[model samples]
Target: MKSCLVVDDSKVIRKVARHILETLDFSVEEAEDGRQALDRCAAQMPDVVLLDWNMPVMGGMEFLRNLRQQDFDTQPKVVFCTTENDVAHIRAALDAGADEFVMKPFDRETLESKLQIVGVA
Candidate 1:
């Protein structure tokens, strides 16, 4: 089965995202911040990463940069899944190698559609 890593500082967000992914038949894992996400990436090598734009410990942008540089086992397809709806942030995420950008408060359909676009949903 396909696996995913959901990264966010909020416990509620993580739980909800995990439920969404698991419901779609994707195995789910989670991290509270970018630092933990990075570590999880190296260890678990999930097929996709749902990353929050902001966090206390290592922000998502920095994590994206690091992921771009690394030659990891999974080389996960990343999606910017955050509350930030600004154009600049979306552009930055795309330039940083995210396969897709999904705004927060998304429903299962919205998330599925984005993943489908990337051949991962």
Candidate 2:
């Protein structure tokens, strides 16, 4: 099965995302912040990352920048999962190397579609 890392500071959000991804047949891992997520990636990169924008320790943008610079065997497809819906924010994320963006309060269908768009689901 494919793997996914759900990087979010909120326990509830992580739990919800875990359920969705698990139901979709992904092996899920959770991280409370970008730093932790980065460590997890270094150990074993997941097929996709569901990243939140305003995490402590390190934010999503910083993580994306750092992750892009690393020489992983297979680059994980990053999808920013956040409340930030501004065009500029989206543009910045895309420029920073995120493959897709999914706004907060998303349902199973929305998440599934975004994952599929990134070719991870």
Candidate 3:
């Protein structure tokens, strides 16, 4: 099965994402912050990373930068899921190695579309 890492500080968001991804036939994992997500990647890199913008330990942008620097057999496709819906934010995310961008309060369909755009769904 395909694997995904959902990174969000909010437990509710993580739970929701997990449910949706699981239904899409993805083996899902959760991380409360970017630091945790990076550790998870180091242990076992997932096919996709659903990343949030803000968090306590580390932010999504920082994580994206760091993640892009890592050497992996196949680098995970990062879908930046966040509330920052500005052009600059989206551009920055894309430039930072994110394969796609999705806004907050996303539904199953939207998430699936993004995953598809990244060629991971």
lDDT at 119, model 3: 93
Tens digit per residue, CA lDDT, model 1, 3-111: 9999999899899899999999999988989999999888878888999999998999999999889987558899999988889988889999999999889889999
Give the worst 10-residue stretch by lDDT in candidate 2: 55-64
Runs in model 1 lying further than 4 Å from the true structure: none
Which candidate number maximizes lDDT? 2
Against the hidden true structure, what lDDT does model 3 obtain?
0.95
TM-score for each prediction?
0.96, 0.99, 0.98
Q: What TM-score does model 1 achieve against the real structure?
A: 0.96
Off by over 4 Å in 3: none
Hey, what RMSD does candidate 3 come out at?
Answer: 0.6
Stretches > 4 Å off in candidate 2: none
Worst 10 residues of 1 by lDDT: 67-76
Candidate 2, residue 27: Cα displacement in angstroms equals: 0.4
Model 2 residue pairs with clashes: none
Q: lDDT: which is higher, 2 or 3?
A: 2
